[model samples]
Target: MDVKIDSEGAFGSAIVTLEAGEKFVSEAGAMHRASPNMDINVESRRKKMKVYGVHLSLSESNVCR
Candidate 1:
């Protein structure tokens, strides 16, 4: 796996090259670009939890909130 960072700053983008069977997990919309061989799965964390009758929402204690 090769990780290449383009530019520099909080708003900088990243280009990742993954070998066969490599897996990469990142925050929502974090991936700027990827190779065609890579398999991309975008999941909604809060939505997936709701399937089991679990509800997750913003909280003051959590920075992501």
Candidate 2:
């Protein structure tokens, strides 16, 4: 994988190139565009927490591949 970043002022963009069978992971809403040949998958991870004897579920992160 190859990564290039360009920035102007406070705005920036990244260009990523991937080889076959390689995967890239990023935040769910970070992607602006993708090539037609790229396959994308979104995954969400959740954690179980117990606070004050109460059970709670929280999302850890959203990853895109």
- Which model scores highest in TM-score? 2
Error of 2 at 65 (Å): 22
Model 2 Cα shift for residue 25 (angstroms): 0.5
**Weakest 10 consecutive residues of candidate 1 by summed lDDT:** 51-60
lDDT of 2 by residue, 1-65 (tens): 78888554555778887766666766545677776656666566444742122111112232234
| Regions more than 4 Å wrong, model 2 | 47-65
Cα lDDT computed for each candidate against the true fold:
0.51, 0.56
Model 1 RMSD in angstroms: 14.4
